[model samples]
Target: MTAEQRPPVRGYAKPVVVPERLDSLTGPTTGIVVLPRHLKWSGNSRYDLDQPGRIADLYRTVLNEAATSDDLSRYLDRATLLDLWSSMWLPVALRGKWEDRFPELRHRRYDPAA
Candidate 1:
């Protein structure tokens, strides 16, 4: 599946504040309780949920940086970043020649078409 079609990574729980003691063997005194793996919130960023192709482009760009061992910040020229992000999402805007063709995918809900 294309990166756009692939499911985003999401396997973590919401943090919950609580009181306990870890050193005392009781656990946190008042911090948070992370839930088990099966029950958790999707870890996707708001941007990713709202814009998958942008997120995909970010992932691709980061991978490129790691491949070259280059500092990502150095390459963050305003135009370059915007170009990559904008190009990556161009497909979403051009999908199906309009909205009616893919009614099911138009709503939010993290769909790539959205």
Candidate 2:
């Protein structure tokens, strides 16, 4: 095909879709969550929230693989997210995307005397 006739290549990266409000996060408070194949096709996908650090692990997984708004709304909660935000280990892309959408999520140190 000629250069002019060639179709432009589109990016495969999906854009992050954050809800309008943090309150929109209404996921389970406490329970065992089994991720679907789409979100977690490999490794163990069951997360027992009752266990130590399991909730954070679950949140990390969901935030990384969630393909739709419903995924986020169904697996993450505002209170839980906020509690783990500072300590949660997240990918740079996910962190940037989420922080960009919600500036309040960016953790900053409180300067006592600057």
Candidate 3:
């Protein structure tokens, strides 16, 4: 498939930063995770993982704002990210970079119209 032209990805200084491996994402699957200052600069920082909507929101925010793969590793779980990828609201650039690096993400469908 051809790539779509869009704005450059932000939050990281380097271009297209993806993890060397996904299994390293061994973060909490439940409970509240209060985001760090660098990750959550504004709004509410605490995310209740038990709540589906809140967790999805948290994943979306973290995925978009993370400065590096380590930031993602610190907050996101591999299973949770795989389960939530299709539903989370994400920027085109952020989503594209991830989907490119991880083909499994491409299989999960996201409908912005929803």
Per-candidate TM-score against the hidden true structure: 0.21, 0.78, 0.80
- By lDDT, rank the candidates, best first: 3, 2, 1
Error of 3 at 87 (Å): 1.0
lDDT of 2 by residue, 1-114 (tens): 232343543442655567778888999878899989877889999988999989998888888778888889988999998888878776655666677677778753233574
**Top candidate (lDDT):** 3
Is candidate 1 or 3 superior in lDDT? 3
Model 1 score (lDDT)? 0.30
Off by over 4 Å in 3: 2-16, 110-114
Q: What is candidate 1's lDDT per residue for 48-81, written digit by digit as tens?
A: 3134354344433332322221223322233333
lDDT of each: 0.30, 0.77, 0.79
lDDT of 3 by residue, 1-114 (tens): 324554555665535456877897878878989999878999999999888688888887777778888988989889988998887777766678788778888888776776
lDDT of 2 at 74: 84
Task: Give model 1's TM-score versus the native structure.
Answer: 0.21
Please identify which of the two predictions, 2 or 3, would achieve the higher TM-score against the true structure: 3
Which predicted model would earn the best TM-score?
3
